[model samples]
Target: MFGNDVRLKLKMACRLLGGQKSVANSAHIDNSNFGKWLKGQPTLSEENIQAVLTAMGLPDGEPDTKNIHCWNIKNSFLNNLSSALSLYFPYTAEMARAPWVVQGPSLKDTLGIGDAPNTLYALTDGKTRAILRMPRSVIIQENNVLPVIKWRNDTPEKSVLLIEEIKSGWVTGVPTVKEFDLAWNAQGHQVTDHDVLQAIKDADISNKEAVRRIKQKK
Candidate 1:
């Protein structure tokens, strides 16, 4: 799951920054090293992580000692700091705060396209966007609105199971797109991408789930 999280975060970051080249430059790492790092291998040092966080425009500070147990680092403070950075400066945050217009599919539809292949758009504020693809087989049914409580970020078991169940339902004739964001009442309001990504990460949902949930009531 850590490996998966890293990959998803990296992919989202790349999309937010416009391209792989931009991410590599912004993170101060080369393409080869970046690829390796995303694969759960840290070819760079701790300072490199700091540099990447800074590149992402997130707050980088000394680690906090209290929240160390939740992380896997020698310095609990730094670990906590890193986790906080990842949470606060998530790919969604970068995209949300970007200067250019970042656009993507709102979970219900793929960039206003039909839902046959079941792909989501990953757009930047700049003139760039990529398709965050998902398996069409995971969709349970279209227009299925599940409660948002089942999609929180603290419990991984429930999140993973819900996503898998959605996929299962999809395989058994459930829709691929499930509406999961009735929590928000209005449209065009402020919905932080950081919170969205964290929820997906904590819940172990795929990018498909992320886009689907956000576009529910809009």
Candidate 2:
């Protein structure tokens, strides 16, 4: 059986893309086989799981690499802020033992959350939640344990999201995260559904038609 988290996301993806048939077509799976995977009739193989996720166009679940010194785009965005901006990080297998906390404006601001002694946060833009994680070792805050953050308005160049310029840094994934960001410049998107591409899938309808349907009701 698929994990509840994966199944739930599958359900949402299917809903957004039109239906199971659409998702199956996008994943290049026969409709019947995809249905079986959904129902767990024979269960889904790991290889197929990756294929489905790839079709979903999500950031790959595995970090591009484990080298902590490497740079990451998503992590670069959280610098010089003051509030909570929790990015959902992946948990290999031990996540089963940890709790899931969803962050909102009241929680803080930004994305690309770093490591913690205990829990990891889940971040969603009402469509999909991108989980995240970064080693605490690479994080250097202005004060202490937490990552550094700044308001770009205070000093356009100083409050930048560049890691080299960060008073401190965080984790990363998905270069497209800014497109959906609701904070700061909101440079990602502020109107309409930002995930239209991922949502269109293989609906067999014109992309324009699908968008019309969504916008009319959206």
Candidate 3:
């Protein structure tokens, strides 16, 4: 029986994780039931709560990942490329080589005394380190060689207006999208966030079942 605050978190989890169906599947609950329960149809259940939280990338016993943030640009663009590639080739699972990354507890938060101060990061691709915040983007910069759009040089003014809100460019020429596509086709994501979440849920369920069995035997 979680309150509105917890309920709101469940909703936010859905947004971050794509949607209700995605969350429901990972939690191993029916989509409709999951929606209703979070909506307070009959209130929340502890079992379902744990499943959902773990599916949303929270560790066991943790209330939520309010402080943790995770992202992967390759996945974001590859998802787009998947949509694009599907239009041309008969797409398969192998065609998609992206992982939904989930960040764990921060050392600063877990080990530090009080509130963590704001900090700017100059990240790296193991070779280059740069800080490119793009003025307003939440993503300061990922120093990896990634896609870029010469949106202004050759692309039409009408097209620029179409993607006006998109914050692209600053990487003059890294790796071409074509090369990225080729490499993506050659390899598949070994394990994905979905796999991790499902494994966490499965392990949790297995542990509980084992405990129940031991109790029954006793």
Off by over 4 Å in 2: 59-218
- The whole-model lDDT of each prediction reads 0.36, 0.38, 0.38
Error of 2 at 134 (Å): 34
Error of 1 at 179 (Å): 33
- Candidate order by decreasing lDDT: 3, 2, 1
Task: Identify the superior model by lDDT, candidate 1 or candidate 3.
Answer: 3
Q: How do the predictions measure up, each by TM-score?
A: 0.30, 0.30, 0.31
Candidate 3, pairs of clashing residues = none
Count of backbone collisions within predicted model 2: 15
TM-score winner, 1 or 3? 3
lDDT of 3 by residue, 63-155 (tens): 231322221221221223222212111222111111211122344433544542222121222122221121111221222212321111122
Model 1 spans > 4 angstroms off: 1-3, 61-218
Can you write out model 1's per-residue Cα lDDT over 1-218, one digit (the tens) per residue?
Answer: 33657555544544434455676797778778866776778676777766765554432532222211111111111212222334332332111111111122244442434434332211121111111223332221111112211112222222221122334222233222121121111123345878777788999989987788879957
Candidate 1 lowest-lDDT run of ten: 93-102
